[model samples]
Target: MKEIESSNLFPDRLYLIYRVGRLAFSSGIFFLFLSLSSISKLPVAPSSLFILGIYVIVSVALLLFSKKPYTFEFLLDEAVIFTLVASNVLNYNFFSIFLIFPVFFSTIILGSISGTTSLIFGLFLHIIFFLQKHNEGIATGVQTVLNSTALIAMFVAGLKLERKLKSQAFYIKELEKEKERTEFYKRLYEISANMAHEIKNPLASIKGALELIKEGKQNERLLEIIFKETDRLDRIVKDFLHLSRPSSPIKTEIFLPEAFQEILQSLQHFGKNYKLDVEPIKFKTDARGFYSTIENIVRNAFQWADSKVEIHCHKNNHTLEIIVEDDGPGIPEEEREKIFEPFYSKNPNGSGLGLSIVNKFILENKGTVKVEKSKLGGARFVVRLPLSEEV
Candidate 1:
């Protein structure tokens, strides 16, 4: 019902009026039936028949009018006014109570100005009927005054209720936005903590290596380890920044096989058997993000593969699919979902951020990556990217 109420099928004002119009139509039909049932006593009465005809026309017109813009509030208020006039023309004691419908709707929906106007008009009609039905008695005047007071009270109360509902809706929206901002900052803090922990060890190792060199330990292996630790620190910082502030994918035409082959070449020493099978097609995606996504996935695969890692790329319709599989012990099904979570790795030496970063880059490019058991007896990472317009 909330979804229905929020739907854009009709503008907000029109939608309210549309609902009221439906109610008016249904009420008019019900009264029309009642009048027809008593038609034998007043057969062919001109005023009753005229009111009946006008009510029928207006009821149908209200339904049709809802389809049009019908934005002007006065138009709906006037329609309800016509309904009140119909009740008056019918002259049935039961029908007079229907005068409250116009007052109720006009005040509740059209606000105070229109509400007060409707009240004045209803009072004028009430006075006419009251004068016709009674002599100048104090009791009659008292009843009229009491009825007017009750109508004014209802109008004021309805306006307050409408304002309260609007305020509550706005408050709920603000609370939701505040909750989102809080959650974002919380996630950011977690990422910063993890990055600091990961980078601290490598910096410490680099510091130890420099200290050893200062103590006359000029071994080539010591210098090499320092360089490797420095590189490790750089990579960690780079990955953190890449994950945090991802750029939007600016798709450009590039051959699928060539791109995959380039990534494979860089990690050739990581595994003995690096195989690539790609469809020769022009694909479109952000080159840097695309490269980072595949590189991180393949590097992880290479770390696990016993002897072989296979890369397969295909294009079908408007989707580009890439699958990287390795020949190693497959990932347990329970951990598959957790692998993409930041700082969640089973490997002791693993920073656990590679797959998380891969997922982020892929998502920024409007792609998805999933891990599953592979035919190669290891984890398989499947990437799906929507193809851009033809270059």
Candidate 2:
């Protein structure tokens, strides 16, 4: 909903363009005055001095309100250019080249009606000023008509260019909105389908467990089955919640060694051998997100790991690279990319969200998680979190 300056036909751009054009024209006029003085080997003409004074006043007024010039201001600028044209005719020198600049500005900024009015008035004055001196030469008439034709061409071109740019901007904005809507619907559909697929298995297991308990009477093992299935459902819900949570990392200061110490200790519940090698590095990041990222990564390693999981952490310049690898069957190169997709588990009982969450957390922290062949001949997952060159 923010208003764009470009959408307004770049009014500020118009100011810049007009000012630059006037500056260039004025420079040309200055050199012309100097050239005339040198050729005649005389002092500057009084008429040129008079014209220069009028030029200063007009230039100052126009420059002062360049951003929001009134229509009358543009008219005044054109009138001055006409005066220059008359002066050029009386002195028998052609300076009608300056006439197109004002016409171009008016057509672009004040619209075609005002621009057409200025053009007509300029041509009318052209006839009176130059045609009356037709006794001078026929080339003068030809040159004046050519100047008028070029001014008309420049005005028409400016109008079309303005219209084309404005139309393209409008279409680009509409396309962006359409693309956003399309992406929203596509993501909605994906989440719905993944949720249904992940939820169905646990619900089925819980229902089956309950039916068996009801027919055979309550028993310790059956109740445990129901409890376990319910826990699985809870985990599924929690994972989905993690995905839906605000993406911005809740950053705080964290010591890498101590944080990993607590994470590994809590991960003892997995009953898997995990060896940790961490450096005493400190930095600011989302503590909870970092923990989640490490936990999901190690848990995934533990799942496919055979005898033990090896974790190697070290500093690489401004990044902290955490390498988690297992000695079990490594992931194939082809499936590595797809493995991080939601509900893309190779394990029969796995819900397949752990690595996906790991990927999300790493990306949220402005980091990268990559899979490669480990030195230990297993799947090595390397997570690099940017430290921004902190010690």
Candidate 3:
């Protein structure tokens, strides 16, 4: 689980591995009984292969998924593993009581309550099937009693281990959070300086425009300069807010056609200079962030295209792929890396925050965007976002 700590001795990975071992150990017992029944006095129950089949299926399910085990799953494991022990007790094979030790080591790896529950379930099976035989042999009775005592002992021991593991996990998780906070603040500090520089130039342009208007009179050309500079400042501030805020995108099921249509309809005022070749994909992502990404990238395409722009979208593996290309001049290889930097633009009137905003939003959504030479001999912007499996 996401809450499971990385540095703990009882890490989730180890628990998963233990489960696999649990499956293997239980399966091996069944295999032994079935395979050796022909050559030896070894007893094979009719349910041995059935139980093994269940172990395999459940083990496969547990390993394929990334989730914590349920209490009932451990109970099932108890049923399968202790089946042989109960069988052995009924057959007067006291040597097989040694199998009870393996239960302690594995169950102790879990929380005390689960371990206790498992032991109770296992002992219940032992009583129902083999407790009557305990009266027939002193050794059977002694080992059965020891099984109960070991349940209490290991349960107390498991509680302490579980507490120690949990506290360590909590401490490590906190350290990870603190480290992320430190890195975030460091980036914030760097961007604050960039924001100030971007802010200064626009303020100076507005001031100069106001001074000229004050000296003579308000004219269209001078007024336009003020408005343009004001718009630049606004764009910079909005983009800065987008970049500076923490990126914790909440994903939701998104219908791709609906999302794309929202942006396409808004940009219809620009003309039919666009062609969309999109797969009718339905997936999950941060819907708001996805719309922003589509709007910004397509708007940038329109700003650059001379005659036509094309948009293509599809799914690749677990990722959603989006490509926006235009017939405008493509970006030179050297300038491509700087394309997404804040306040960097080739067009004189551009705020230069469009691609930067696009990049920020994509990254926040656990996606990537890149520029490449389009097949149409122009710049192509490619965006990829991971698909949520729930969809």
Candidate 4:
């Protein structure tokens, strides 16, 4: 069941109650007239007025109660029971007809179980009342039963229609989300194309200037800093181009422990200057996405860690779990969530797309990623990958 948001809870409950109360009030008035008319031909005894008084009081109380917050289940059950008893007390042929309306209405709104329960309860009351007043004729009982059966049929049809509508709504929502994603990619491609065109001339000019300066003429430290910054810019541009391009078709399979170990080994070159400890465990995951995701995260940990980083893996029922943590200063609490957003970074020199790419890959593989304070006294990234069913 979809959880009801706090904002909509009270108003929805009140609306349902108000609607049922209105129906009850209208039915109560109609029955009042019928009962009065039926007793007119007979003596106007004190007993008649007393029963009439009880009906009036109950109706008034119900009308007031209907304004309060109540569930459909409570309303349907109470209405069905009250109507059943009232039908016998009024002793009118048309009184049983009122029960049919509530029965049909309950089925349409309360779903199969509650609706059917209300119908059965009302049916039982009708049978008992008819037996007590049998001299009225067999036609009346038959008509009542027929009406109840028709109401049940209508309820089944209404449920089918509701399910169809809900499915359509879900489909539309998915389409809307896809459309938004496409538009974002479109805008990204346009911006990257423009940036590449505009930056080419400046990049060529800087490269030419650096070359013209004799190999030993420039200060070694200054030359190194300039080269590093240029390389960083080049990497950023490459990342932008990659993200703007159409994604490659995914061919995924269950990747074993060895495949993950290979990815970790490849990333180890980047962290050779730092002390890195990698722990492997047997697990299953989508090969393509898992390789790309782990490589990105491990490389990121290497960039931040001072002298040590750790990788651990484990398996939970139907899922492969991995945690990558570093001994570097952890990300601030306020920045952890936003770090996965595209082009967001706390470090001035960071490209900002590393975690974002990891996030995308994890989602595509039907997995999840979360960041928290690690047991290793730094940021820890926990990834959960669903086990591949095909393998």
Candidate 5:
């Protein structure tokens, strides 16, 4: 992201250039009128007076034009060119110094390249003044050079400082965004967990009654299907409750690979009938939070995987990376961001809270989860957890 400069001097930085330009032109007009009035008392040339009048008219017109919302490019180029022309016409040697104001102002408002261009244009105008015989020999040259050089130096320094400020601003923005995401997931987890806890008893009662009905001499296949569905719903409600409630406060230092081993063992016991392939590698993370987060992800992977599932973990500096990939149908890009939202499941049978819960767990543990195309030709979940040292 590009950083924008914020200074209290201007209400809006983009509009500031024009504001400064208008002020400069108006001030130039007042001084030009004073000079012309004073010259009138002396034996100045008629040509000089005529030139001053023309300068005033053109400067006023430029001031009015500057009031409009012209592009920054046009404003800088036109303002500098016109100011230079006006200075030459009015035989104003001090106008070059006044031009420096806008150049410095433009650099602060626009950026380095623009400020430098304006400064160079001002230098070219000074050269024009020198050639026109408007200003004298070595003294005028030296003064003009010194003023232009100072303006250029100020602009360069401002550019460097502005860049530094912008970087800090961008970093702050990123931090804020991460904070908001964390808060959102935190609240969502709390609310869903509470609702799930409230409904758990009722779901359990229904599941028990359904099982009793299946145990009785009801139609065997129909009863079995109903019982199975009730069981799925019961598991969904339990998952919701688990996500809603806070885990035990106790934390342990568990190696990442051992955590995955436990998750694989649990998945095997839970999904013995379903085909699953578990691959493991070295991992380092917080034991309890990492276990919960991985369990949620692995469960989701199992649900989405057709008959194949792959879990891979890698290590980077200060982060343990895990990729849960499946061979089932992948999610579309448009729905990727929303899938992590609570109650946004794609499967008809899903409660839509699994990924939401996963997101909450990851965030609480200072990690992030994102969806992408899996190497297995299905949905891939990329998780990044801070290393133990960072924690």
Candidate 6:
């Protein structure tokens, strides 16, 4: 909408440059005519110089005023055009030919209404000038009519062309936006499909377990299974809800090694064998997002590790890199990328939301994560984050 208004309201840079170039060309032609008139000793009216001087002044004024609001600058240009046409016509009747500039400019810049006004003004001035001269009546009238008609015709043609170009540009912009929207919906559909598939299996299991418990004696084992499945579903729903919510990081200062030490202390209660090799590093960023991301990654590592998990953290220049590896069955090369996708998991008992949640938080915090083969002969997850200058 703004584009449409701008185009109709003002002459673009190309048109401005074109007008300046036209002025230069006209200057050259005027100088050439002056030289010829001097050589031939023709009695050229001194008023011609005054008219040319006035034109140059108006052109310069328009250039200076071009930066003004579109409507104001346009009206100013039209006024200058009128002044030039009136002065030139009155001084030298034949010079009304210069009316072409404003006529065409109005058409391209201000659209049809102004174009029509310019056509009428040009015709009116030229007719009045011809009457004042009162010589070669029919020829002058014929010339005036022809010139006016040609100027109007050019105005009409320019208006049509400008409208067509603007329409095409607007259409192209809309199509590009539609294409992006379509791609977004396509991704959404894929995520929805995965969610349904993941939720269906657990729901069916819970239904069967509940039926067993009701039909037979309420076995504690079956009740336990139901509770476990319910918890799994709850986690799935919680993570899904979290992912759906828009994320905005609340940044704060945090020390990397201190944060890692706290995470390790919390996990020590699980009695899992783990190793930590972290360098002392400090940075300012979203502390909650950082903690949530690292916790998910390390928890997944512990869940899959055979006996031990190795954790490593280091800072290289302005970046902090953390690696977690498990001494268990490593991820297959083909499944590495899929592991980070929502609702994608090889473990039958897994909710498959862990890595996706980690990835989401990291991305929101402007950090990155990737998976590879670890030195421990198992899967390795590496996360890199930009360190703030306050570090």
Over 1-391, each residue of candidate 4 has an lDDT whose tens digit, in order, gives 2221332343346446646565565456556656776877533344444555564565556565645423353345445444534544443455445555455445444445655666677667666666765777887678667755665665576567446545665666666678778988996886566456445644675576577565655666656756776887787776655444444565555445566567767866665343334334444344555566687787788778877788777667777777888887988899888888666766666666667778877776688999999776778999987766534
Model 2: how far residue 342 lies from native, Å: 3.1
lDDT value, candidate 3, whole model: 0.72
* Per-residue lDDT of model 3, residues 270-332, tens digit only: 664888888888776666666767898998888788878999999898888999999889899
Estimate TM-scores for all models: 0.64, 0.61, 0.60, 0.52, 0.47, 0.54
**Candidate 4 segments exceeding 4 Å error:** 1-230, 241-261, 264-288
Tens-digit per-residue lDDT, 102-198, candidate 6: 6666666666777777767766766675676558567667767776677677777878866876786677667767877897899889888988988
TM-score of 6: 0.54
TM-score-best of 2 and 5: 2
Clashing pairs in 5: 193-244
Pitting candidate 3 against candidate 6, the one with the higher TM-score is 3
Best by lDDT: 2
For every model shown, the clashing-pair count is: 0, 0, 0, 0, 1, 1
Best by TM-score: 1
Of 1 and 5, which scores higher on lDDT?
A: 1
Q: After superposition, how far is residue 251 of candidate 4 from its true place, in Å?
A: 3.7
Error of 1 at 64 (Å): 16
lDDT of 3 at 101: 37
Question: Which tens-of-lDDT digit does each residue in 308-368 have in candidate 5?
Answer: 8877777777676778888889899999998877666766666667777778778877788
Candidate 6 residue runs with Cα over 4 Å from true position: 1-173, 265-272, 389-391
What's model 5's lDDT at 109? 62
lDDT string for model 1 (1-391, tens) is 3433453322356446655665565567556656766775544345545555565565566655654432244344434444444455433243334555555555555556766776677677557656765685676666666666666676677668556655666666676678778988998898778778888888888889899999998899988988888887777777767777756547677777788888778988874687788988886666777788888898899989999888898886888888999988979988888889887777656677788888887777678888888888898999988877545
- Judged by whole-model lDDT over C-alpha atoms, candidate 5 comes out at 0.65
The C-alpha lDDT values of all candidates are 0.70, 0.75, 0.72, 0.62, 0.65, 0.72
TM-score of 3: 0.60
Give the clashing residue pairs of candidate 3, or none. none
